[model samples]
Target: MEKRVVVTGIGAVSPVGNDVDAMWESVRAGKHGIAQITRFDLEGQKVTLAAEVKDFDFGDRRAAKRLDIADQYALVAAREAMADSGIVSGENVDPNRFGVYGGTGIGGLATLESEVSKCVKKNTPARASALLVPMMMPNAIAGNISMEFKAKGASFGIVSACAAGTHNIGEAYRNIKHGYNDVVIAGGAESVLAPISFSGFANMTAMNPTTDPDRASIPFDVDRNGFILGEGAGWLILEELEHAKARGAEILAEVVGYGATSDAYHITAPDPEGEGASRALEMAIEDAGIAPSDVDYINAHGTGTPYNDAFETIAIKKVFGDDTKVPVSSTKSMTGHLLGAAGGLEAVICVKALIEGFIPPTAGLQKQDPELDLDYVPIQGREADLKYVLSNSLGFGGHNAALIMKKYED
Candidate 1:
């Protein structure tokens, strides 16, 4: 029998707020989290702004001392999610049946940069800490989460650039649905607001150079520039539906379908025809056994970049037709682009929208792009009785992912 997968708990450590409730409230209000970059000196960088998690404290002295920023963010969010799901100490759940899957675009870049700089200054490799390799590996986030929660089942990392977060959660959904595991902790985290990362992105012209917070990330807007670097994490506790119900877990939403594809066109840019992204969307809708029109909302992979927004718009039109009026919005307009964490955070937002009956807006969208004609819930949120929501995440290397979520029924 095919098992059903459902989301029982969510946790977020974002730039807007440190916790899920606070972040959701800010998102609902269309608040912007972007501001001056504080992680490093931005004197020579073209992009001086970012959405950085402010005043973050893990509250565990050991974790604070040992973990990298991304690992710390992942651990904190995972802890909150596990607690919210009432899976205390693995008493009711088998630790081996639980799993961890995490994603990150540039895991522990800050730590790597620091260690390299120390080695350079000391003129010897001995200056680097013994923990540097484990701390900087992309898999560290998932490994640490698994160690923290004692999840012995299939713990691993997903590293598909910006699509990584969505891929992680999507893979976790599949794991539970196929009876591989009863519960999975899945999400993405990133903390690359350091000097090297900032300079690299700025020089590549991938980040918005605008300094104004409100104007920095206007996705799908006429004046859209580029994405704003954001640091944070989002985690969800996904479980088999029957297992969750048996434990009296408060089901948030159902994971209906997932689709992932590659453009094979450009390394850093989306396919001009948007074929890969369109196919992913079509596959997800088909996997969900629903027509495109049945989807009420879309959390777009709108990074506020010219190529990304335009290509994504073309992809949406291709999947749903040009005239289809499904309301779409990019929470990145407010939260900035969380990169690998974008899909994970957006997935949480989709589930929340299904539960809360309100669709968040693409904040700062004063004037719609004349080229793109779609109902992008602009400037403000709207009350909507959304049943099924789709979230997209397009990454570098042509990676595209789409996830379809439905309000839990019976």
Candidate 2:
């Protein structure tokens, strides 16, 4: 028999707010978190802004010193989620059945960049630290998280660029639904605000060129340009429904469906017709046994880039129809693009939206693009009795993933 999966706990370290409650509050008020870059000096940089996690404290200096910034963010968010779920590995749940599935787009870029720079500048290969491999590997996030929680079951990292987080959650959901695991810690983390990353993105014209924070990440707007890089982590504690109920856990929302597809057409740009994305959305709704019209809200993958927004609109129209009234919006307008962590954070937002019955708006989206017509819930959020929310995530290398979260009921 197929088991049901529910999200019992969520945690976030985002640009808008460090914790889930604070982040949701800021998102509800349609607040943008974009600002000038502070992680490094931008004296000679074209892109001068990013959505950085301000005033972050790891709370463990000794442990923080041994991990990369991305790992630190994951650990902190995981700690919060573990505590929120109140599931001790050995006491409430079987440590052997618990699992961790984490992801990152650019794993430990800061550590890798720093070590390589040191080696080149000193003209000695031995300048690299012995802990470089363990700290910088992409799987380190999952490994560290598993060790932290003593999860002995399936543990690994997925690196599908920006869709990595959603992939992580989707994989975890399936694992639990298939009865392979009773509990899973799943999400994504990213902290690559280093010099090399900035230069590469800027040169590729992926980062927003505008310096104004207000207009930096204006998704679906006619004036939209590109996305602002953001860093942080978002995590969810997913547990089997029966297992959760048996342990008296509070179920926040249920993971009803997940759909993932590959464009196979382009490496960076989405299919011009949005065939892949539309298929993913359709597959998700179908997987949930719900029609497209049944989706109460849609958390769009509106990266504010010209190609992404336009193509995503095409995909939504293809699946939901042209005159669809679904309240669609992009939280990226406020949180900026967390890249690999975008889906995880957006998943957290979707679960919260289902729980709170509030629809967040695409902040800073004033003039809508006439070409792309949809109710983007612009400028400000409003109250709504949301039943099911769908979150879309499109990544480079033509990856598209969609997740459906339904309101919990007895």
Candidate 3:
């Protein structure tokens, strides 16, 4: 028989707030985190806004100076999660049975850019620091997290763009269900709020042009333009049912099922038909052995982009049918787009919604897009007795991932 997996702890370092409670409160209150970019000079950039982690002091200046922002975010969030789970040493849980699975879209881009600038100014490759390569690598966050926690089993990173965080949690769930590990620290982190990163996205016309934080990421609204880039990290502690019970851990929510698919049509754009996304939803529902109607709420991958919002609506309709009145919302309206960390943060929101009995709303949604009509819990959150919720994350590389989380029960 396959084992079951449950979320015991969650940690977040997000634009809206530094910790999970503060972040969730901001999300629930419909507060927007996007603002004018201040990390670097934005003189010639068309897009000058982002949702950045504000007033974050990692406490240890030495570690802060040595590590990249993404790595620091991951480590901080992981430390919080580890503390919340109360699994510090090998007394209750074996070190070999613990694992780490992290994800990121563009890891340490700021570090790479800084090192390159130094090399160019000094006119020599030797000017770059020896740690430059490791710092810039996408897997460095996971490597550092594993070493920090002493997780000796199945330590690695997932790099599926925006779907990365969901993929990490999904894969970690599978690992525990199959008895490969008893516990896993899984999530995604990203901090690419640099001039080069902004310029690239702006050049592609992928980011929102509006400077107003509240209106910038207006998903499901007819006036929606595009997503606002954001930075942060989200981590969760997932453990086997028996192991958690043996230790008397507080179960937050159960990860019931996961589904991943590829559009195989475009590199950056989703298939207009949303066939792949629909299939992923179907697969996740099937995997959970639950009917479509059973899912009470949906945390949409609503990027506020024209193509993404419409295509995601089509996919949701295809799976749950047009008549389904499932309340859907995009937390990105407040948190902006956390890239690889989007899925992880959204998953934490889903679990929180289950536990708190309330659904967060899409912050800036005013006039709903007529063509895409659904109960998109607009403008404000509402109290709901949610039993099961699904969170979707669609990435740039035709990657589509869905995770089903249900209220934990004995």
Candidate 4:
């Protein structure tokens, strides 16, 4: 028998704000977080704007120093989520049955860059730090989170480029739904706001080179060129439905469906036909056993890149019909592109929209591309009775993932 999974708690550390409430408030107001680079000097960098987390403090100096920046973000968000869920290991839930499924696009890149620079500049390969391997490993975030929370059931990180976060949540949902785990902490974190990261993205023309925060990440707009790099973390506590009810947990939403597919065509560019993405959306809708019309809202994976935005439109149309009336918007316009954390942050937005009966707009989306026609809810959010919402995430390396979240009703 397949069990049901529900999201009982959520947390976020984003550019718009440090915590979930602050981030959601800024999102609802359609305010952006992108700005000029501040983590490092941009004297000769082509890309000047990034969605960097501001005023972040992990509150524990010793612990913060031990973990990489990515791990720190994950730990902070996980702490909030664990507190919000009120689930104590060995008390309400078994520590052995608690799992941690985290994801990251480029984990601990800051540590990697730092260590590599030390070795290269000092003209000696032995100049690297002794703790470099553990700090910079891609799975370190998951390992750190699992150890912190004593989640011994399943602890691992999924690396699917930008789709990593959504994949983590999806896998966690499955882990609980199949009776493998009672509770799971699923999310993603990223903080590679270093100069090398920026240079690579800028050289590839993957990032918007603009300095204006408002216009840097304008999704679905005709003038949108590319995405701005954003760094932060978002987390959710997914529990077995029965376990949540037994503990009197406050359920925010239900994880009804998950769909994952690969483009198999390009490393960075999406398939022009959007066939793979379309199939993923179709699979998710079918998995939920719901009609396309049942979804009240869609949090699009509109990355603001010309190919991504246009092709995503086609994928949505493929699943929801050409004239579908479902309200669609890209919160990335405000949050920038969180890479692996994008799906996590967007999933948080979907849950909040479902709870508050509101739809956040695509900030700075003043004009929509005439070719792509849909109710984008541009510039300002509006109230809506949202029941079911879909969050889409399409990453580099042909990764495509979709999650269907239904508002909880007992």
Which predicted model would earn the best lDDT? 2
Off by over 4 Å in 3: none
**Cα lDDT tens digits for candidate 2, 264-294:** 9988899999999999999999989999989
* Residue-level lDDT tens digits of model 4 in 254-363: 99989999999999999999999988888888888899999999999998999999999999998899999899999999989999999988998899999999999998
Clash pairs of candidate 2? Answer: none
- Estimate TM-scores for all models: 0.98, 0.99, 0.99, 0.99
Question: 35-134, model 3: which lDDT tens digit per residue?
Answer: 9988999899999889999999898998777789999989988888888888864777898999999999988999999998889977888888888988
How much lDDT does candidate 4 score?
Answer: 0.91
Worst lDDT 10-window in candidate 2? 37-46
Give the Cα lDDT of each candidate. Answer: 0.91, 0.93, 0.93, 0.91
Total clashes for model 1: 0
> For model 1, what is the alpha-carbon lDDT of residue 19?
88
lDDT of candidate 1 over 225-318, digit per residue (tens): 8999898999999999999899799999999989999999998989999999999999899989999999999999999999999999999999
RMSD of 1: 1.0
Against the hidden true structure, what lDDT does model 3 obtain? Answer: 0.93
